[model samples]
Target: MPEKFVVVGAGPVGSLAALYAAVRGYHVELYELRPDLRDPATTPLNFTKSINLAISERGVNSLRQTGLTTLVKDVVSSTTPMKGRMLHLRKQGKYVREAQLYDARGKNLLALDRTSLNKTLLDALESMPNVKLFFHHKVVGVDFNKKLAWFERRTPSDPSSRGTEIEISFDFMIGADGAHSAVRYHLMKFTPVAYQQEYIDKLWCQFHVAPSPKDGKYRLPPNYLHIWPQDEAMFIALPNQDQTFTSTLFLTRQGFSDLDAHPDRLVAYFQDKFPAVVPDLIPADELVKQYNENPHLPLITIKCTPYHFSSSGVIVGDAAHAMVPFYGQGMNAGLEDVRVLFDFLDQYPTDRAKALDQYSKVRTPDAHTINDLALRNYREMASDVKSPLYLLRKKIEETLDVYFPGLGFATQYSRVTFSNMPYSEVQRRAAWQARVLNCAVGGLGVGVLGAMWVWGRGGGWARVKRGVLLGCCWIARGVVGVVRGWE
Candidate 1:
């Protein structure tokens, strides 16, 4: 008989995990706290529309590895490709927009509806005979050493009412429950796992920009993720298959309260800051309706060590590392955990304990690094997106990438979004590139100072200019050569 594999949380990550185990001939049972999301009456996320997910290479590769190539293609086909970040800035009573490509090599992020993607995975799992999905079965406890788990089933007559508790045994269990995971909470009792969680001061509220009333086309360009960067708050919109955009407004708690206190001020504030959005994409009345109706949700960051318990159970996805959504890597990272976990299993099929230990040791640093990156990107997305210096640095990096292809030059966004490079390694490399840029600027500064001194001497000014230009050329060539050599 094949080993019994139990998975908690039937979200995308858990559904994918169940699919993987079923493919390996395991008798897989997937449990969820809620009813089946495919039901038309049942909502997946609390919001009417899901927060958009950007499916990048890391997520795509993980899905492809499942041997479900057609599923991957179908999900990808449903998405809108975001080739760049379209920045919206207000100046002198008018809005000016600029496009910043994610990668010079033409890589793009696919904007996917979270609900649709989860449904796709869940539907795929339903088709497999070896996989059984048990909805409304909430995992209440786990005994890691005994390899036994307990669930509180919802009464069928009244789904809100609690039913009897039952126990199930598993050869192995996977937990992709989410940030407030009961599995992770219970696993802590059986094992000494260090954990940390914090709620950022900012909260996010959802908004919607309907398609053009005339022809039902996109109000804004569909090819980019639109961003309006205010100093203390930000608004971003991602396109959907229905031609509308899901907009999220992020602000501090105090800011949200201020808006709540004076509702009329909200329209005036948007007029002054995010000009043209009120009457252009979303009408003034509709904007107010969304602002009043939608809930303000907190953003949390979670970090933990030793995401497993003695080879019997392991935590993946948000349960392992829940990060804020600024970097657009939360889902991608979670899906990656599934891929990485199975890679270790494939390596140590017999010694599962060793595989689990190795996975915790190797994956923790990358997870923490991504958490930090997400926090940092929140600041960049809200404020730095409008900075001239930030834009200059972005242009310089892209220029180097275009001129020196052999040097393997890339921006931080490209490394994080366009490639599957390790997150920790990407952090380290980006720091090195910053230092290189700083040194180059320092050299130019020294050259200019030296030229000024030569002019003061009243004789060597021409020679000094020539020398400075030559020195800059030499430094640029050397930097390119050094970067290429390192690669």
Candidate 2:
């Protein structure tokens, strides 16, 4: 008989995991705390999640590896391709927009609705004969030694009223539950898992920018993620397939509280900070209505070690590492986790225990790295995007990447979004690139200064300019040689 694989939390990660297991001929049972999302009457369990998300190479690659040829294509068809970020700001008392491409190579990220993506994965899983989905079932407890799990079936009519608990036996269990995961809570009892969770001071609220009434098309540019950076607070929007945009306002808790206290000042605040949004893209009245209606949710970051307990159970997605959404990699990383875990399983098909052990050992650091990067990206999105120095560095990096492709030049964003490289390795390589760029700039500056001093003694203005150009070229060659050596 094939091994019975039980998966808790039928979110995208769990659903994908179940699909992978079913493909491997395992009898899979996927459990979820919420009802099937495909039903129109089912209330969404946002759990502080954004309505839309960015799907990058990491996530796309994971779906492709499932052996479902049409899955990736189908999912991508429903998404809008955002090539870069579009900054909305005021200059010289007039609102203006600036475009910042994510990659020099014209790579793009798919802007997709969270529900649509989840439904696609769930639909794919439902078609598998070996996979059974148990919705409205919450994981209550687990016994790793005995390979057993307990779940409470929640009634839709009265969610507070719980029905009978059911006990199920399985050969292995996978936990892809969200931040407040019951499976992770139970796993802690079996093993000494070191866990850390942090709630950032920032809170986010959703807003909708409807399509234009005149033409029934997008009010803002639909090819880029729109961002209005206001230092301590930022507003962002991602295009949807229906010519509308799902926007979010991120601010500190105190800022949210202050705004909540003064409801009338909200529109005026938007007019001052994000002038282009108010009265044009989203009218003041509609903006205030959406703000008053949507919930202001806090951001949470979670990091845990030893995602698996012996050979019986393992956790993926937010259960393993819940990160802030600023990096746009939360879902991608979670989906990538399924691929990585299954790759290990394929490697050690005979010894499941060893495969899981090796997975936990290798994945923990990468998970932590992305978590930290997501946290750091909050500052980048909120303020750094507007900084002249930041833009200069980005331009220089992109120029180098375009000119010297053989040196393995790439921006951190490109590496994270356009490639499936390990998160830890990406960070390390990005740091190395930063050091090389700094060294190159410092060398060029010193060379120029020395040339100026030499030219001051006897050389004329024309000679000084010629010498400066020669010095720049020499330093550029030196930097390229050094980078090649490192490579």
lDDT of each: 0.88, 0.89
Q: In model 2, where do residues sit more than 4 Å from their true spots?
A: 47-51, 454-487
| Superposition-based RMSD of candidate 2 using all C-alpha atoms, in angstroms | 2.3
**What tens digits encode model 2's per-residue C-alpha lDDT throughout 318-424?**
99999999999999999999999999999999998899999999999999999999999988987999899999998987887899887767889889999999999
- RMSD values for the candidates in order, in angstroms, are 2.1, 2.3
lDDT of 2: 0.89
Candidate 1 lDDT over residue span 368-442, tens digit each: 999999999988988888789999999888998899866666899899887889899888878877767776876
Best by lDDT: 2
Clash count, predicted structure 1 = 0
Which ten contiguous residues of candidate 1 have the minimum total lDDT? 42-51
Q: Give the TM-score comparing model 2 with the true structure, all chains together.
A: 0.95
Model 2, 176: alpha-carbon shift in Å?
Answer: 0.4
